[model samples]
Target: MRQNPERRTALLDAAIEVLAREGSRGLTLRAVDAEAGVPTGTASNYFRNREQLLVQILHRTRERLVPDEATLTGPFDTAALLRDLVARMRRERSVHIAMLELRLEGTRRPELQAELAAFHGAELSENIRWHQDAGLPGDRHEIVLLYLAMLGLIVDDLTTPAVLEPYSVDGLIDAMVARLLPEQPVN
Candidate 1:
């Protein structure tokens, strides 16, 4: 019932670890509190129930997964930005793994579907902000497509290396970016 920012974050980290290690079925406030090494009631103090805890996981994943805006700026270097994105994904791999697990569980749960939708809406808002900041030409629909494509690529890059040479990370990113953005004249 009490709010402690640091403990709440610790609980979220523990939840991610539990989800990654044991899947959504392992995610309960008691489990999270135990994993966090906090008191038995700590996680429940922060999250009302399992759905609420899962929603927090989604929020934390969105917060941790999006490429930092400050890092994404300066030049329109799709390859470099994507490289950075991949690096972030690798560095926070557990969070992403948990997200993937949640995405699967969401298919069977309506509350989770709503929470996942909010996570995606937040992601799209960030994409739109990045596009506007970079002076990129894509509107929301195009951005949505681009985001989905890149998400697929990210999952593939993390799980399985490109089976085809043309689909290698660099080639894949270049192709995705080229398809999304309008052509520019040579300098």
Candidate 2:
């Protein structure tokens, strides 16, 4: 099969749209083809199977969630970063829903579980690198805790929308920053 990046991206976008609008249960090759304005055979030709298509969508989602290396810098403004993270999460609602579905699907599919784990591991690595660059003082255990806390925020925001009102991401970031970097009193 010819490698047409544009067509592939279009198909992936279509898949995400379908999943977002109709949920994972409604996702099908024909649906994606119609959404992408491509023929059903073309969609099938690109993704040999439904599983492969779903995996591709997940991969694309991972790419969006993980910040670029260039964006990871030292002494990051925690509040600003938190706001950006929140925005990114909100923008990727479809991906989040798809991830939840993927987790359930992983129960019977070991390969899916492995893929999810690998993606999570990569996310952790990126977080660790960002923390190191930010001059944060902590061992791997501490950094892991921070990362877990961030994940908790994401999950909470998604599952319980009410949490966002009382404790905004910016507020959480402020609290975390205070704990991570105590202020030095002026002389």
Candidate 3:
């Protein structure tokens, strides 16, 4: 029998919830089935093994988190992008935490590390394309460095936003943009 697409998505979401709630160790097929309120063997029917399940989760995360072209082309300023990113991060907090769990889990698992690197590389390529489409002023390397710096900001703000409470999100975004973004000279 063919698997239901909705059922597969539900299982993936359940897996993400399990990872967020109980960390990576709890991401077993049994756990996913339990979270989805399905039979014990359902997860196994969909994903061949743990690595396969993780790969699905990563793909689903990118589907939800990757913005469409309109958002990319609408307004290309750093502050606007940061504001949008902060909102998205907050909205997808569970997914973000689950991603962190997966990354830490990847440290001991070579299979996961390779899979994640490939996904990350693709994501970086899309980001570079988005920047070019938006007419952002930076080469790929500079954009990559800016991307890492933004990740630091996102992670810090997610973990202990109080550390940056004095600056306010907008102000901090302005400071980050000022430091990292290339300035254009007046014509």
- 61-175 per-residue lDDT for model 1 (tens digits): 8777766777766867765677678778879988988989999999999889987887788767977887777866566677777788889887876666554345567777778
| TM-scores, one per candidate | 0.84, 0.81, 0.91
* C-alpha lDDT score of every prediction, in listed order: 0.80, 0.75, 0.83
Candidate 3 wrongly placed segments (more than 4 Å): 68-70
Residue 40 error, candidate 3, Å: 2.2
- Ordered by lDDT, highest first, the candidates read 3, 1, 2
When 2 and 3 are scored with lDDT, the better candidate is: 3
For model 1, how many clashes?
Answer: 0
Off by over 4 Å in 1: 137-141, 161-167, 184-187
Task: Output the lDDT of residue 110, model 1.
Answer: 88
The TM-score between candidate 1 and the true structure equals 0.84
Candidate 3 lDDT over 114-134, as tens digits, reads: 988998898889888878777
Q: Give the worst 10-residue stretch by lDDT in candidate 2.
A: 177-186
Instruction: Name the best candidate (by TM-score).
Output: 3
Give one clash count per candidate, in the order shown. Answer: 0, 0, 0
Residue 153 of model 1, lDDT score: 80
